[model samples]
Target: MSLPDFSGTTPQERLASLRRSVAGRIVFTTSFGLEDQAITHMIREGGHDIEIVTLDTGRLYSETHAVWAETEQRYGLRIRSFHPDPQALAALLDDWGANGFYHTKDARLACCGVRKVEPLKRALAGAEAWVTGLRADQSQARGDVMAIEFDTGRGLAKAAPLHDWSREDVARFCETNGVPVNALHAQGYPSIGCEPCTRAVKPGEPERAGRWWWEQDDAKECGLHVDADGKFVRAKEAVQ
Candidate 1:
């Protein structure tokens, strides 16, 4: 991959350029979270030709699944669904016995690797660039999320248009545009992920407090975005 000179520009401008370059081959991955919803609206409004996809981690909330159906009907775009390898899942289950994630951090990460990361790797295999709803305000690790990035960590070119958007900005966009959202957000589930691993956050809490609440401070991410050495850096390294 040639590292082209991308003068640091605003997210909107970067998105416009990406659209012009990739045309209809770009893909967006959404989980129907607030940030994801905002991204979907922006790409649509900007008139970018990109396909949207999502991974049904097999343990997602019912509300998330329901919104998927509603979103497709509302947007009139098909969101291709990706699933984990059934044989791989069966093997993991047999070795770890299910619910092993609750036992240790390593165990939990292993489950997430099989359920989310592996499936995502397959989903992005043929794509030139992928868009995500990740926001810089969501976590310190993501504080440097740029509009365009080479995701050497995941072996894909990644673009995060809403990386600089705040939580309030995302909410306003969804409210103003009538974008369908997960019902649990209104119930105080600010950060939504797998059902078992996520819970409703208390009032006046950090947005991501609900995700991996049982783990220590720095162990929030699910290994899907981490480097080979188990470090979570802000920018993606060179994809040799």
Candidate 2:
């Protein structure tokens, strides 16, 4: 399928075309990040019709939840929630203990698969197109992000409307549009995720340096970005 042409068009016009084309099959996954707030604002203000949802990993920051509520109240949009399979999570924890991920890369990834990737897979099932807040400048793995691309790993057509946006651009859009954002961003948590697995970045550290900080060189992402292609190689392999 040919991707929607999101070029040369204003954000409003492109959003309208996306809504008309996908109808009810388009959805946005909001993690309550700054970029998400900007995109949600655009979609809501532009009057584009699409489903908005989030994965309830059951471990997000309270600030994230606060923003989630504020975003809904401020925008008057119903954001659906998807959760992990409780039974599966319980089984995994029973077998590996609550924090076993800290012991090994495999264990950490297994936990992510159980708690995040699986739930997201189910949440996105049957959707024709999924939108994200990923930007090329966010990480080494995301440097090649295209505005519209196929997620071969997820079997979904992914749209990253803000792929080329700088952090300042995202902030400017949010500030100019009155979009609600998570307080954690102002607190140095640029990349928000499950609470226990995330932390605040220190001065002069990379934005993601606080995440999985104990693994030395060989670890970074959990598993969400590694899936089928191994687009991101484990740093351990590079050291070897």
Candidates' RMSD to native: 2.9, 5.1
Q: Residue 90 error for model 1, in Å?
A: 0.8
Give the CA lDDT, 0 to 100, for residue 139 in model 2: 74
What is the C-alpha local distance difference test score of each model? 0.78, 0.76
The digit string of per-residue lDDT tens for model 2 on 1-240 reads 556545534445655666666645888888888988888898888777777888888778899899999999999878999888999999888988999888987777778888778988888888888877877788766676666666666666677777778888889888887889899988888788888888888898766777777677533776655645445522111000
**After superposing candidate 1, which stretches have Cα over 4 Å from the reference?**
3-13, 236-240
Error of 1 at 204 (Å): 2.8
Native-to-model Cα distance after best TM-score fit, residue 139 in candidate 2, in Å:
1.0
Error of 2 at 196 (Å): 1.1
| Candidate 2 worst ten-residue window by lDDT | 231-240
Model 1: lDDT to the true structure: 0.78
Residues 1-240, candidate 1: write the lDDT tens digits: 643233335555666777776633578888889888777777777777777889888999999999888888888888898897999899888878778787788888888888888988888877778878877788777677766678776555677777777899889888999999999999989988899899998887788889988887654887766777776655644211
Give per-model TM-scores.
Answer: 0.90, 0.89
